[model samples]
Target: MAPLRPFLARVEAKTLLAVLLTAAALWTFVGLADEVAEGDTHAFDESLLLALRSPTDISDPLGSPAIETAVRDVTALGGVTVLTFVTLSVMGALAIRRHGRSALFLGVAVAGGQALSHFSKTFFDRPRPDLVPHGTEFVSTSFPSGHSMMAAVTWLTLAVMLARAEPRRRMKVYWIALAALVAVAVGVSRVYLGVHWPSDVLAGWTLGAAWALLCLLAARWLSRRGDIEPERGGP
Candidate 1:
């Protein structure tokens, strides 16, 4: 076998470094969660409470009724439901249109990430915080918040798909940034409404981001293997 080129070696090193960093962060988060579970909730829970309390005085000009209504509407199944359905539908449609092995890889990546999120939630089984009034009733386990995880996974997946679909750098940045902002907002909302602890949100973010990266890597690998063609249309 021939020796690898210097540039290729550097690229491989950088990729390995990134994977290591991600793994370390994930391990740290898991350890933090474990510590919190052992009655050291001061670290994450207290910080979140302080942050949420600071914004309490900033009144929503619309009043409690309007605020509640808006929150309810946003958090309602219908709001994100439509977005989710539309995104997945488009991905499926595109995959069929492409009809390649790469599409199979993309499909698995997206679906597997979703399944992993659900599995993680069930494994954690941590309860939601009762410190503040919950705006919406929820019954799921709290650690690694479902809303936060799902938001990150879905939006990030869409962002990846959008990036792959387009070649313009500016458009790619805009699409990814918008998706990221929405995901972060949804995660923050969970804490603000007292439905999830800060640790839950943090874990959700860390794991969700890692999962998205993994999915993107899978897509890239498939593309390299000539299993799927790069999307040429504007996203």
Candidate 2:
């Protein structure tokens, strides 16, 4: 109890909050995954899938073609090629700015997330929803939507990077809000396209959010320990 005080003293309130939130989200994801695997979520997943589609035709989606095309574009924002390009581009920018630590951090955070997403899919081995015709082609197991995870990772990572450089509180808020919107859009697009179960997107969101927050917490700790520079103006 006495030694706990010293450790607790070193952690900031916000860091502690992030840790708690991350734990809560991660546990939620785990619970959902277990239930999904046990088939408890089958009824709910199918119901939600049907509710989001045209009542008359599962093949025909709910939106206009133009809107469907727009959703595809949004979903593409989380596609492998797009995320890879965005990751390299942002890391390149960080390196050019001489924020080597930040560049490395971003690289590991995203790459790790990709690997984790893959591992989760393989582990769960959940098939994609077949109740409707898929709007986009995909080639992976589907317990968790990869697009949803990547969207959260890329957008949230960029949001943190940009927010750190912002001095104004509102600017930081704006970046975070915009990032959340994009992430949510990607998840919704997955369900709308009939490529993923609603639970898959929920799991992806929870896992991705937890992972991003964990990375942020690591960045904060490393900055304090002089292992990495803070993102005050640099990385």
Pairs with steric clashes in candidate 1:
none
Tell me the spans in candidate 1 whose CA falls farther than 4 Å from its real position: 1-21, 50-64, 76-80, 92-106, 231-235
Q: Which candidate number maximizes TM-score?
A: 2
Please provide TM-scores, in order, for all candidate models, with all chains considered together. Answer: 0.78, 0.93
Best-performing candidate as measured by lDDT: 2
> Which tens-of-lDDT digit does each residue in 1-235 have in candidate 1?
2476765665655356657756875786688668767968756686655565535552222236666566555544212475468566757756666644444555566567668777888887886776666657787788887777777666776677767766787888887898788778777777666677887877787777777766666666666677677655443
TM-score quality measure for candidate 2: 0.93
Task: Tell me the tens digit of each residue's lDDT in model 2 across 1-235.
Answer: 9979999998778888999999998999999999997999999999988887888888887879998999899999889899888888888877787777888888888999899899989999998988888999999989888999888977898778666655678888898899899999999999999999999999999999998898888888787787765667322
Off by over 4 Å in 2: 1-6, 233-235
In TM-score terms, candidate 1 sits at 0.78
